[model samples]
Target: MATAKLKMSEVRGDVAVGVAQGGATVHALKLEGGKNVPLCPTRPKNGLRHMGLAHEQKPDLELCMKCSAIVPTGPVTVTKEQVSIPGLDRTVIRKVVRPVNDTDTTTEEEEAPVMAENTTTADPRDAQVEEIRASIERLPSLLEADNAEGAEELNGEIETAIAGLGGKGVAALRKTLRAERDKALAAGEEAKAAKTPSAEIVNLETKELDDNGKALIQKGIDKVKELAVNKFQGGHAIAEIVLDIRLGITTKNGYPDISADTDLGKKVGGALIFDDILAGLPEEGEDEASDAIRAEIGSIKKSARNAMQDVKVRYVRSLDNSPEEAKKFGYALEAHPDKKPSEAVFTFHGIQSLTRAEQAKQARELKAAEKEKTRLAIEAGELSEEEAEALSSDGEKSEKEKRTETSNKLKKTALKLISDVKGIEDEEEKDEALEALTVLFADLRKALTAK
Candidate 1:
């Protein structure tokens, strides 16, 4: 048997162009037999012979089989290459020849290419500095336009470009940039100030209280008396009044109650009444008492401060309301006695500070809670006695150990609370208690393990 010979004329499909394994560009003839015949151009002549066509010289031209016409396969026009060199006085430029097959066109051309100056050479550092200077000059306009992001990006570019440069030039440019930024900031603040209204707190003269105002003031006094009798010692009359006022327990007339039965309270009350009379006594030109209220309020506030040093008073208020309103009311309480009853109506509430005995009770409860927690953890086999003792010891423990102890305590509390819920006879009460306990336990667990 003889091997069959391959004929190019017998090839019957489309022709394709590809690069050879060695990186030579060649034409492949697709054959009816499903094989490719790669055709390489002859060297020196740079001509290809295929399908009976001989000595085809133009590399960029490919032959069309149907028309037998040569067509260009790539770009037709040739672009000239130029190089730019930035100088102090002017940019230097030079033109160089590039071959058609070079493919690399990375060098970007200037919008208006210019001839070079004879005295200068191309220096990249000079170009970088010029670019940085241009960016710095544009920053103020960018900021004024509120293009802060663009300004920041440009600033980074400028800094990076000037990082290698030294001496007064860089320093001067940096100073100019800082000045521009500061000016922009000042202008913004000035515009803001122009748009914002200034608040004026007027100290109005106190007017005589009407029937309603008197009744409200009496109510506030009664509330304070109740607080003092129940929680505070006799010596803490001033502190009690201040605390009551702070707590928003104003009289039905809206005036904060400053009345107390103690001697100190009597003295303070006299001063306050004097202040009120002076406030309402028809201004008749600023009376001494009008100015004296400032000193009086200040003195009372100082005494209240001293009282709080040894006591823990928690003032509860609406989340949406300002605490400052209550404070201002307290300051203006003396003027309340002189104001109309309607105008004297205000709200105040205060929780009395824990007494020494109460504090001891809380401490005992906390210790009992800790003991219960330790017992529960031991019973659950989650903690050993040795570990529990170490945790309870006076020796400093790591944060992890502290957290573990807290978690154990919270778990014990949760279990006890859950058990107690079962004893509630009312289904609704039991359900409510269980729901509240669940929420509390979840919150405590999160707190104990929080990073």
Candidate 2:
């Protein structure tokens, strides 16, 4: 039983959604006992779509099997005592403090004449929920008024309110509000109708969607095209030679799945790519090419970082015409056409791969430096070899010690064999000897691991 982060519905009574904790999303019901049960043993064929407990809740929330089930038939004690759910590594259950109901059933005459000043008050969360509902209702009008700042302020307020008093209703409202904002911004962009002739036309099937939705998709496509054009630098451009941009827009949720036809290589046609420019000194040492490459790489990293920043700001632009959000989600471009155009397809990972490689290199360098320091300390007599070994070990018999011993033994054997082979003047005989040693070692390893 997985521990679920469940919330009571605000839009309807006796309804809730259980948000399970994992890599993939799931549909489950959180019982009064706080145990989560999957809605169906088998996942829906169409996949688990949104089952938000709000107004306009999708019709796909029905149970898979119409089998009879047992539910609690009597009043059960509900306590805040924490209970562990087995199999789940971690559990996070929000303690919801609901206002206690006043059950004063005594007649007027039987009631206490004097009370010690009744201090019972309504829960502050209730008031906050009301405020959130009010703000949500006002969002459409705010967008209509073209008050971007005011709308942003209201959105911030709603986010704060929901953060304090979390429920499926509030989340649904926020989603709706975000959709409205996207639609409004898209409408404005469409009205301007600034068509780009040079821009790559995105071939997407958006006929099934409404006008506003289509506009939103178009706006996103245009943004991607614009970003590709801007990020592209002819000389220092890398792998992806963007021949065509295709989008598969989900009408259920307007997020576009972006991909492009690309050509992967160090150099596309005769043009110098990113790697070629990086290795500049061998051919064009300290020249304008080197300077341009440095500048271009710097600009790329800066823009990539800025795009990441926009994600923290919730991927919504404060201004309608901003391109940072689009750039964050779009792929890099190439100015020069590839010799073999559309040879391969690409997704967004060029910048990420570079960053990850740099990080790995830094880690390796740091580890080597630490090892060097230990060796120097041993040589200087500041630390004894025994003490160094002890410091590096976990216990009396460490895995590290075992690995080092095995590695040293192998190296010694290889060196002795190489020395013996070096004395042989005939290259063919020496190669044959080395090959025999490799076969012997490989057979020995197989025998050792045969169990």
**Number of the top-ranking candidate, with TM-score as the measure:** 1
The list of candidate 2 runs beyond 4 A from truth reads 1-124, 166-451
Structural similarity to truth (TM-score) of each candidate: 0.23, 0.16
Q: Which residue pairs clash in candidate 2?
A: none
| Candidate 2, 115-223: lDDT as tens digits | 1111122222344445556676676566566666887787776665444433323444456445654565565444434542333454453548898988999999999
C-alpha RMSD of each candidate structure in angstroms: 27.1, 33.0
Residue-level lDDT of model 1, residues 210-241, one tens digit each, is 89999999999999999656443432555655
**Local error of candidate 1 at residue 5 (angstroms):** 53
lDDT of 2 at 372: 87
Backbone atom clashes (below 3 Å) for every candidate: 22, 0
Task: Quickly count the clashes in candidate 2.
Answer: 0
